[model samples]
Target: MLMILLAIASACAYGVADFLGGAATRKAKVFRVVAISAPASLAIEGLLLPVLGARWEAGSLGWGAASGAASAFAFALLYQALSIGPMAVMAPITALVSAALPVVVGLAEGDRLSATEIAGIPVAACAILLVTVKRSAGVGRVRPKAVAVAVLAGAAIATQLIMLNQAPHDSGVAPLIVGRAVSSLIVLNAAIAVRRRIDPGRPNLGLAAGAGCLDSLANLCFLLSARHGLLSVSAVIVALYPAATIVLARAVLKERISRAQWLGLGMAALGVTLLALG
Candidate 1:
């Protein structure tokens, strides 16, 4: 139950952060947005280090770094896909792929689910699809390239979860923090090399910083949850972050939510409740 709660909390935090990050990308360069966000994340993690305490082994460090790099790559690809693809198609597909990978891995690792959870999987997938579904009057459809990138991003996310699962149980949040910092640096450098620009600007700087801080905090919570519970279950619960994003988009972006999405949100909630109980 505690793990499920932590995962929910992490999902909320991540949803907000991702929304902010996506918003920032509209006004700033993708690389710049990520670069600024990365340092902000590092700062937040740095402050939390005292509270979380440092407990890391060499193995944990390696795995954490690997996770970070994979995440950075995922982010890059996702941004590229978003630039060229429809959000309605790309976001949900990527999210579903990301969510599915850990569940599959967990099943492979002999993690058993209750009958309720077993049913919840398809429901959750449907919910994810509903949340991302957009009603277009015109003839805009999903791009194949965007789908490919989203799939890759999902694979990267799954890899991150798997690596984190392999991290030392007693390593505290140090390995996670270290991994995030390294990943941020790598992303920052890549952005610099590719764009040859580093403009933080005025308002966007603050937004990026805030997004990074929230993201880092969310990552911390996710690591803590994974350490305390089954990785597959934790991943599934945390993967529900997109639900929050959908709700926020409706409220903030004035986007219309379909009847299906409302139904999806309700189903996702029920599924999560069953997961928690399980």
Candidate 2:
């Protein structure tokens, strides 16, 4: 139950972060926004690590670093794919792959789920698809290259979560610190490399920094949830993040929620209930 609650919090945080990050991208180059967000996240995590406690374990740090690298690559591929492909098609594909792979990895590593939990998985998957699909947006012709890149992005996303989950239980927020540090460096370097091409428009630092802080919170919650519960469960619950994002878009941006999205939101609620009971 506690894990489920934590996972829900993680989802909400991720949703909000994504919303803010999306807004920030309109004002600045994607890489520039990420450079700011990554370092801001690292700074917050650094501040929280002492309060959360940590152990300097090489194995844990290594896993964290690996996750960080995966995350960096995932973002790069996701942005590139989204830039060229119709988001209506690519988003659901990426979400499904990211959610599914962790479940497979967890089960293969001997994690067992209750019957109810297993039943909820498909329900949650359906919710993910419905929430992310954006049928109203109209799926344009998706290029083969974009579809392939989207899949790779999803794989990288799953790798990040799986690697983070593999960190030792006793590592505390040490893994998060290491992961943020590595990702921050990568993003910062990328921003520097392409500084000349960056848009001269004023960047929205506030939104980017807020996204970073929320992202840090999301990561911490996910780490705790994965450590306490089944990785499959944690990943699925967290993947429901798109539902939260949709809701926020409706409420804050005054965007119309598609019928499918409304249904998906309800399905997400049902799935969460089932997982919690299981």
Clashing pairs in 2: none
Per-residue lDDT of model 1, residues 1-278, tens digit only? 78888888888898899889878878877677777888889888888878778767788789888988888888877777777887677777788888888888888888878887787677777777776677666527766777898888778887877787777877777777878877888887787687746565533887788899999878877877877777777787777787788788889999777897888789788878777777
Residues 1-278, model 2: lDDT tens digits: 99999999999999999999999988888887787788789889989977988888997899999999998898888888888898988898888889999999999999889988998999999999999987645665678999999999999989999999999999988888898888888878888998998877666999999999999999999999999999999999998998888889889999998898889988999999899989
Q: What is the lDDT of residue 209 in candidate 2?
A: 92
Question: What C-alpha RMSD separates each model from the true structure?
Answer: 2.1, 1.1
How far out, in Å, is residue 150 in model 2? Answer: 0.8
On lDDT, the candidate that comes out on top is: 2
Question: How many steric overlaps are in each model, in order?
Answer: 1, 0
Per-model C-alpha lDDT, please?
0.79, 0.90
